[model samples]
Target chain A: MSDELYDDLILDHYESPYHRGRLESASCEHTELNPLCGDRVQLQLQIDEERRIQQAYFEGEGCAISQAAASILCEHIEGRTLGEVEAFDARQMLDLLQVRLTATRQRCGLLGFKVLKTLAYAYDGTAGTSA
Target chain B: MENIRSDFPILGRPLADGTPLVYLDSGSSAQKPQVVIDALVECYQTYYANAHRGVYQFGVQIDEALEGARERIAAMLGAAEVEEVVFTSGTTMSINLVAQAWARMVLEEGDEVLVNEMEHHANLVPWQQVVRQTGAVLKHIPLTDDGHLDLDQLQNCLGPRTKLIAVTGMSNVLGTINPIGRLVEAAATVGARVLVDGAQSVPHAAINVQDPAIDFLAFSGHKLYGPSGIGVLYGRRELLEMMDPFLCGGNMISEVGLTESTWADLPAKFEAGTLPVAEAIALGTAVDYVTDIGFEQIGRIERALLVEAQTRLQEIPDLVIHGPDVDHKGAIISFTDPRVHPHDMAELLKRKGVALRAGHHCAMPLHARLGVVATTRVSLAVYNTSADIDVLIEAIHYARKVLRRD
Candidate 1:
C-alpha cells in the first residue's frame, strides 16, 4: 500500500513538478495551509473569456503526498472549464491519487484539490456557500 | 535497564502487523509501567470514592491517597512544603494557572515577561495571552546558531519591569538543556520571578525546587511515565498564598455568600473541584519508580544512548541535526534531510515499527528560525535501548534510499 502511494508516478511528479510557479496574469489565486504540519499550497489560474482554465500553476512546500498531489492536480485541471473544476471534490481527488490514505494523509493529498476548488468557487462568485 | 523495560508491558507487545515496536516518541508521552497501570485499576475497582467529600471509610481512604500523592510529588520536586505543590490537568494547565492566577495578579501595564525562542507553545502562548491582557511587553531570549539560549542577552533582557522569566528547562525539539539555576540568578538581579517549564526536564533529571531564586516549576505526569490528566505546579509558599484562586468553586471556598465569597487555604485554594484521584495516585507511584532507579543512573544510561544515537544519526548523508552538541543535550534528537520531508520520513519509519514524532513539535517559531517547515524527532525514555536507536537509524536509511530514488 505504501509502495503504491509513493509509486514512480507520484515520486516523479514530486521530484520534478509541472506548472510549479506563479502565473504572471492569473485570473484567480488561492492559498491554503495545513496548520498541523505547516504544509502550504498556493494555486493560480488563468481563465479564458469562456470561463475555461487556460493555464494552472502552483507553489508550495509539503510532504510528497501533498506536493505531488498539487502537481497532479495542476496537470489534471489545465484547459478544463470552471464548471468541471468546481465539480471536483475530495473523493474525486483521492480517486485521482489512486491509493488508500489514512484520514490525516487524505487531508494532505487533497490540499491542492481544495485550493483549486476554492479558486473555481471564487471565480464563480459562490465562495463560502458550500462545505 | 532491561529489567526497567520489563516493567512496561506495552514495550513487549508487537505492532498490529506483527512487527516489533520501537517506541521513541517519549518526548510527547511515555509508556506506562505495569505498576502505574495496576495502581489505577486497583483504585477504580476497590475503594473508589470522590476525594475530600465523604466521611465514609472509602472517602477517607481516597482523601488520604490524594494527599499522599501530593506529598510524594512535593518530595520528588524537593519542595519546601507539600502545600507548595498544586495538582493540575497537565503542564499546559499548570502554566495557564500561573499565567492567569499569578502573572495576571502581579503584572501591570509596561511590565515585561521574558521567554526564550526554544520554548514549547505551552510555555510561550500563555505568556503572550497574559501580556495581551495586561498591556505588558513580551520579550524572548534568542537562540544561538547551535540551539543554546543566548545567555549573553540575559542581562540586557532583564530590567525593573521584568516581572517574570518563563523558560523551558529542556527543549523538546533541540534537546538543549538550559541552566535554570543561572537563569534564576539572572532574573533575581531585577527581582523578576522565574517559572521553569519542566515538562521535558523533570522526567529525565532530578530537580530541586527549594532554591530561593526559583519561583515556580511545572511538569506533566504523562511525560514522566504516569497517567495523563495529572500534573504538578510547585510555587513558592508565599507566592501561592498571596495569589488569587484560578478557579473558584465548592472545594476552594472558605465562605460563600450569594454575591461574594472567601477562598480556601493554600493548596485547596487553587484546587477548585474534584481532582483526578486515580491519576494522581498512579503519578505518585511513578515518582517512586523513578526515585528507586535514581537520576544519576538514569542520566548515565541516557547520556550514553544519546551520544551513540547522535553519532549514528550524523552518519546519514545530508542529514542536519538541529541542536547543541550531544554532551549539552538531553535524550532527544531532531534532524532534517533535504531528500525526505519529515512527515514522509515519519510515515515510513512507522511502517518499519519505529514510532517517531514529526513536524514543528509545537515550536513553529523555532522551526522558522531554523529555516525548515518540519523535522523528525526521536526522543528517548528509560525503556529505549541502543537497539531502538539502531532500528531508528536503519529505518532512516531505508526511508532516504526510497525517497531519493530518481
Candidate 2:
C-alpha cells in the first residue's frame, strides 16, 4: 500500500525500520514516553570491544515520529561509538529526520536521543564489554 | 439552513496543498458562523466598555448588553429567569464553579456524590477533589453495554447519603443520548442536587433546564457555534442564591472593608473581576443564529450523517461501533478497526484532508469500561455534509491498509 500521507523520509523509515529489536545482554537500557500522545519507547544498547557500538535496538509502540526516529537513529549510529552519538542532539536529529513535528512530537522524536545521551553518561570513561 | 455552510469562513479556505479541508471535530470545537464573528467585531468596534460598575453611559450600555445576553441564553435553555444564568469561561469552569461553591458549602463527611461513568474528566475531577476535601465518598454509576447509563445501578448507587449527582446529558465519546430526565428524577428521590453537563448535548439539540427540573446545567459557547473562553452555567434562582461565590473580586463582592466583606447578588456574585464581555455577547448572537436555522433541521442533518457513517464503518469487518445503535444518538461516532491503532488512523485521515480526534478522548473511565484502549472519533456538526462521511470511509480503508500492512 502506498502512503501518500507520509513524506519520502518517513516512508523510507517505515518500510525498513532500523533498531527494531532488542540487543542480547545489552550494556545499557533506557525508557522514554510522550505522555500527551501516549507514545512510549524502551531502548537497549550493546557496546563491543574497542569502545564501538556493537548494536542498538528499541522496542516500543508509537506514532510515525517515534518509529521513524528510532529507525533513522539506528541506521546512523550502528557503527559509531558513545562519543560520536553524544555529540549529536535534538537539532541534529530533527535536521536528519526533516519532518514537520509539533512541539510535543519533537519530544517524541527526540526521546531516543535523550536516552542515548543518558546511556553515554553512564558509559563515560568505561572499558568496553568482552563481547 | 440552506446557506448555513457558506456562513463559516474556514469552510471556504483551502489547505496547504489546496485540498479542501474537511472538518469533523465539532465535538472538540464547533466552527464559528458569520453572525458570531460579526457580534465579536461589533463589541470591539462600537460597544467596548466595562460592565456592572460603570454608572456612566458606556458602562450602562455594556451592562444592558451583558444582561440582555444572559436573558437570551436563559431563553435558549428555557430557564425560569435571566438571573439563573451565570457566564464563565466555558464548561470546565462552569462545572468547577458548582463543585467549589455548592459542594464546598453543603457536602459533609458522611455524604456521597453520585457520578455517571460516562462523565468528562472536567465533571469527574471536580467532584473527586470536592469529595477528597469534604471526606465524602464518590460513587460511580456504571454504563450499560450500549453505553447508556444503567438506571437500575444508578438507583442502587443513590442511597440516603447521596447529596449530589453529576451526569452528562450526552456521552461525548459514545454519542449516547442519556435520559437526563430519568437520572434527575432518580436523584431527586434521594434529595440530591443534579448538575447536567450539556457541553455535548446543547450543541446538537435543544435543552430545557426548567422542564428537567435540574438544579444546574452547564455548556460551552464554542461547542454551540460561538466564541471560545465563554460558557453559561444555569442554576435555579433559589440554588444560585443559596450557594457561595467561587471566586472573589470587584464585581462579585458588594461591600469590602479592611475587617469585613459582603457579596453581590445572583449572577454578579459568581462573575469575578473582568468578564469575557465580547465572547458573552457573541454567544448570545450564536444562540440567535442557531435558533433561526432551527435545531430540528440540524438534528435531521446530523441523523443523516450518523446513518451514513455507521453504514460505511460497519462495512469494514473488523470495525466495531462503541455506543448504542439508535437514531436518537448524537452526531458523534467513535469506532476502532481491530488491527489499526487509533493514532495511526487519525494521522492517515489528516493526510487525506480529514480532521478527526484520536485516543482515549478524555473519557478514560468510559473507554476502559467499553473494553477498548482507544478509538478514532469523527464528530459531526451542522456544517458537515454526507460527502465528508464518504471521504472518511475511504480514509478509514486507507488507514486499514497502511496500519495492518495489507
Candidate 3:
C-alpha cells in the first residue's frame, strides 16, 4: 500500500507496467523459476533479422520485485541488441527497484533479468540456460 | 543477576527508525543475550581450531571447548551418552542428516514413515525425501478438528510396514505441544524408530530425551537464544553407530590414502569439515544461562505472557487463534485478524517498532488445515515480559483501526 519500501522507479513501473503480456508470435522465450520463494515468470521475445529485440513481453505473478522488474526490463530492452540486454545484472535491477533486498529476496528481484539474459544467450544460438 | 533484561544488549539498542525495538518474532528466531554473544567471541578469539584432529595447544583447547558444548547440550536434553550429540548447521540440516543417514541406510521399499499434519517443513520434507529415495510410503497421522494429533486414528495409521515415526515436539506455527512420549511409545510398539523435531520445544520448556526413550532429537541454537548456523542432532548411541555417515569428509574419516578409508566414531562421523565452532560454544553458554535461571521460572514468565496475550487477543472481535483446544500450548500464539491480511499486519507492526512474522510460518499444511491462507505469529522467549504483550495488543488494535476499513 505504501511505496516507501519500494524504489520510486520500481513503484512507477509496477503502477504503470510496460510490455506486460506475450507476443502473438515470438522468436525466443524464457522462464525464471525461483525455487526458494516459488516466484515464477515466463518471458517471450520477438526479435528481427538483425538480432535486435523487436518486442519483449513477459507475463507472470510474484512479489512486487519480480513484477516491477519484468515490466521495467521490457521497457528498457525493446529494440536493443542482445549484447546490450545481457549487460543488465542484479545490481542494476536492485538500483531500479530502489530498495535493498535481503539474501532471500534478491532472487525475486533478479528473476526477470536472469530469464531475459538466458534468452539473449539463446538468441545468439549459445548453449545452456545459465547466461 | 541484574534485571536479566540487561543481559540482552540488543534490547537496549534502537531500531533503524529510531524507535525502541520490540521483537515479537522469537518463534522465527530468538534474539541473542550478551552472555551467548560473549561466549562466541571468546571461543573464536581465544580457542580457535578444528576439533578432534590437531594435537597442538590451541587445537586441544578448541577440542575441549567444542566437546564441552556437546556435553552441555547432551546434559540439557538428559541424553545418556556424550557421544550422542552431533553438531549441524541448523534443525533443517539435522533432520536432513537423519533422513540421509538413518532412513536411507535402514529403510527399504514397502516400508512406511508416519508424520503428522501439523509438522513444519523441516520435519516433513526430510521424511518425504527419504521416502522418495527409499521407495517407502509416507503417511500422515491425522489431526483432530481442534488441531490435536488423533491418537485413535494414529493406531490405524501404523501397521507392519511402518519403519519410522517422525513428529514435532511443539508446533512452530500452531504452538501446540504434542504428547511426544505417547507417540514414541506407540511407534516403538511396532518396532519403529522415532525422531523428534525439538526446534520449537527446547527454548520454551525442559526436555528429557531419556524419559521419552526417543531415538533421535534435533534443535537449533538460534531458536534457543544462541547463534544461528548451528543445531544439535542427538541420536541414541547404538542407533547412531549402526547408521552410516551422512557427510563423508576430512573430520569424519579416520584414515584415507587412495582407494580405501575408515570412518570415525558415531558423532564425528556425522560432523564433517570446519563446523560452526563459535556457534557451538555459544550454545553451551545459552544452556548454562537457561539452567541458572531454571526452566520452571522461564516457563512461568512465558506462561504468564501467554495467558495475558490469549485473554487480551480474545477480547478483539473476529480474531481467531489457531491451535489445540487445551491451554498447554507453548509460549507462542498464531492468530488471524479477519479485517487484515497477515503480511499487512506484520508490516504495520514493523512500523510500530514491533517485529513479527507473517505467512504460513513454514507450516503450510497446518495453516491450510486451519482454513486460513496465512496468519501472524507472536512467539515468546524468556526475555519477553507482560509489558511486551501489552505493546503487541496495543499495536494490533492500532493496525485494525488503520488497515481494516472494510
Clashing pairs in 1: none
lDDT tens digits, residues B73-179, model 2?
A: 99989998888999999899999999999998899998999997888899899999999999999999887888888877877898999999898888899999988
i-RMSD of all predictions: 3.1, 2.7, 5.8
> How do the candidates rank by DockQ, highest first?
1, 2, 3
Model-by-model DockQ, in order: 0.54, 0.34, 0.08
lDDT of each: 0.90, 0.83, 0.82
The reply for model 1, stretches above 4 Å from the true place, is A124-131
TM-score of each model's B chain?
A: 0.99, 0.97, 0.97
Let me know the TM-score candidate 1 reaches against the reference structure: 0.98
TM-score of each: 0.98, 0.89, 0.79
Docking quality (DockQ) of candidate 3? 0.08
| TM-score: model 3 vs. ground truth | 0.79
Deviation (Å) of A51 in candidate 2: 8.0
Candidate 3 backbone clash number: 0
Candidate 1 lDDT tens digits, B1-406:
8999999999999999999999999999999999999989999999889988999999999999889988999998889899999999999999999999999989999999999899999999999999999999999998999999999988888899999999999999999999888988888789999999999999999889965357999999999999999998999999999999998887999999999999989799989998898999999999988989899888988888899999999988789999999989899999999989999999989988999898999999999999999999989988889999889999988887778772
The better candidate by lDDT, 1 or 3, is 1
- What is the overall TM-score of model 2 with all chains considered together? 0.89
